[model samples]
Target: MQTVGEVGERAMIALFTAAAAERSDNADDVVIGSGDDAAVLAAGGPVVVSTDTAVAGRHFRFDWSAPEQIGARAVVQSAADIAAMGGALTGLVVSIGCPPATPVDRVLALNEGMVRQTHRLGGRVLGGDLVSAPVVVLTVTSLGSLADLAPVTLSGARAGDVLAVSGPLGGAAAGLAVLSAIEHGADPGLAHRFSALVDRYRLPQPDLTQGPIAARAGAHAMTDVSDGLVEEITTMAGASGLAVDVDSAAVPRPDGLDALAAELGVDPVRWALSGGEDHELLATFAPGDVPPGWTVIGAVGDAGGGPTVDAQPVGDLHGWQSFSET
Candidate 1:
């Protein structure tokens, strides 16, 4: 079997280019796609760009997730960032670092995963780089088109705005807990009951369409739940000079999360509030302008120093930070 070193960088690029081409619609903006040294993109108005990284043993494990899942997860998170900015995805540039001894097939599968996920949002992989490393490291930079829409920033939130989320929260964290339990001798049968959570951890499906929807609905500020809910809300509050008050009872949890939490002797609400990587959109809007799909969870107040949950100040408002102790 050929390893990455044997197949070489050019060959690897060829594989990725072919995979991207197969899945891409060849949009006119992507005039120069993956085969080139750099991709050329044309935008009618403002373009939003964001980048995110995933690493082996940190972001994921090959034993727990397939290469495709890893690729999709990386792409989804980056796309979610663009979505958070109230933009529609246009293209992606993915760079990968892996051991030279890694199998070429694994690399191809990773590229396929990125291609597949981008294709789902009507986007394509424009270009990227490959390098040898001690472990797998993937970085994705996503580009989006605003289409003349004003970009929403965390600073746009104001006092009296309502807080809401576009989709379910805490599912990814719950999924991680289940995976941990299985690793430590928990019953595998439980997997049948929590399959959605497990799948979510492996491959998060962010509501990419919601970003533009929220923008159209006049969202004042927006962010994705890449970190825990409290952490993100706090960041937004701090940025906007407002105090966000979350109603814990109103935070939406997945359908079976309560049952799974009961089985694990964990608090479902805590997971919903503190779990990261859900990639759900959290936005602040005028009370009467809350979008149809969003679930209202809280309200913004004049800056009283920080954020609160149920009228009390929040403690331990931390989330996924790279290099922080797990």
Candidate 2:
């Protein structure tokens, strides 16, 4: 906690550097992990490194989410970050912090889940750390290579760019709602849809294949919708200094989203806008450059900065903050 509070990402990294200097194997390749906006890894090709964390109760609950599901979820979200960078997943380093009283079987199950998801997402765990904490906090860093390919960024989008999303939204949101409802003793129909939502929460399909496809198609800018659709679109808009107008109707919502929302007495649009965890790709394409896997959703506009849906402003326009108490 002191490392995170008194020190930022840089200073905290320096502490780790001092600790790792004692190790003999990684003496040379640990370049620039202490100072940059991103870390430097000595991959044969362009470096691709991304980090993600999953916590108990917020990101996962043991009673509702199984051990294997929680493990796989961690790997999926981390790999999604690399894919969002238009990089292929080559390796993952996992760190797990759990209470000492936690069962050994549960730990093994979690590792199995991580292995299964890593293989499914085209990656493997190169190394990891284990520590004791009050709750399970799993952090994963994924490394990959661009292989002489250009790195796609979230800031390349331009005005008049056509916006596209690769897959349907609202699946994970719907599933989470179902699980919540069941816990609260809601009706069966509303609760039965938990399977689909749980799938989104557990096994996020990051379209590992489409990042390169979008790049090949001349995508102006691209990102994964780990946050809700509205929030991520707005992020791209901010990064590119433009406004993104998403046609809400153009978003391909998955099966049972509306009815599930109705049962919860909530607006489906809210889930489509604010509810995150659906890790689909949202990108902007140059005119006549829409890729095969991408679906056109909206257009890049000039005014009213940040992200909007059908010309209406989206809430907050940011992804889930791990530290914000508000």
Candidate 3:
């Protein structure tokens, strides 16, 4: 187990470059690959860009998550932002910071995870920088192209639009709760019974394909559910100058959540509303225009100034804030 200090920066860069080169399905816009000062990419129409950072202990625990899982998570979340804008991915630029004592194999595994996830979306890593630090930090910047379609903005929702989601929600938040319980010495059988929730938290499978699908289907507004469902809907409503009315019963909760919530003695509906990081696509569409995969959970109404569920304003609306004391 060689440490990063022993391998040195140049050697580490070579290792990462080789790993990135293994991804064969790079987009045609990737004119220049890794091992350069900067990557050169071709742009056609509007270029959508987004960046996200994940810090160890804050975003994840090394003891609970494999290095690859951490890496995959960082990539997926950043890529989901591009998808929210209804763009097809072009490439990614990754920058990693870790302690010198970190194992070289761990860094390599992290890169492998990034490669695997990016390749899944028909993209590849262009280049990145590795720096010595006190803790593990990964920053991924994703670039995408909108082709001929207009990029969906959060303010495009009309008063009569329908609010829909591309996939299930609340699974990641439940997974987080399960992991915390396991850390506090919960029964192993509990973990075995709800392994799917744990896996959802470990590595979220965001429906990246649906972003473009929703855009093509005439989605007026869109955003990713990285924050809790209510928090994001509030943002959309505020931006669009409309009130969003959510049918509490119509909101899609993940499978096995009711049983798990009962065991934990918590409200499953609250989890679905407030639990963040599901990374599902939340979009607004005209009546009867929602794509086949999206589930209509609510509707937009005349500006009542905020979001309401079951015709009542929600209290305690909060999600994954970078500075919140959870």
Look at candidate 2 and give me any clashing residue pairs.
175-197
Candidate 2, residues 1-326, lDDT tens digits: the string is 13233334344334333333333244244454422344444577677889998999878899877898898888878887777777788767777777766765666567668767776766555556667788888998888767666878999888889999888877787787777777888766654445676677556665777877777677778888877787788678888889988887877777777776776788876677666788887788877998776778899988547788888777564446567562
Q: Which candidate would rank higher by lDDT, 2 or 3? A: 3
Q: How many residue pairs clash in each candidate?
A: 0, 1, 0
In model 3, the runs with Cα more than 4 Å from the true position are 25-27
Residues 146-238, model 3: lDDT tens digits: 889899998899988899999888999998899898789988688779988878888889879899999999999999999889999899988
> Of models 1 and 2, which has the larger lDDT?
1
With a 3 Å backbone cut-off (N, CA, C), the pairs that clash in candidate 3 are none
Whole-model lDDT, candidate 3? 0.89
Q: Whose lDDT is greatest here?
A: 1
Question: What value of lDDT does candidate 2 attain over all alpha carbons?
Answer: 0.72
Candidate 3, 16: how far from true, in Å? Answer: 0.5
- Superposed model 1: Cα runs more than 4 Å off: none
**lDDT of each candidate versus the true structure:** 0.90, 0.72, 0.89
RMSD of 3: 1.2
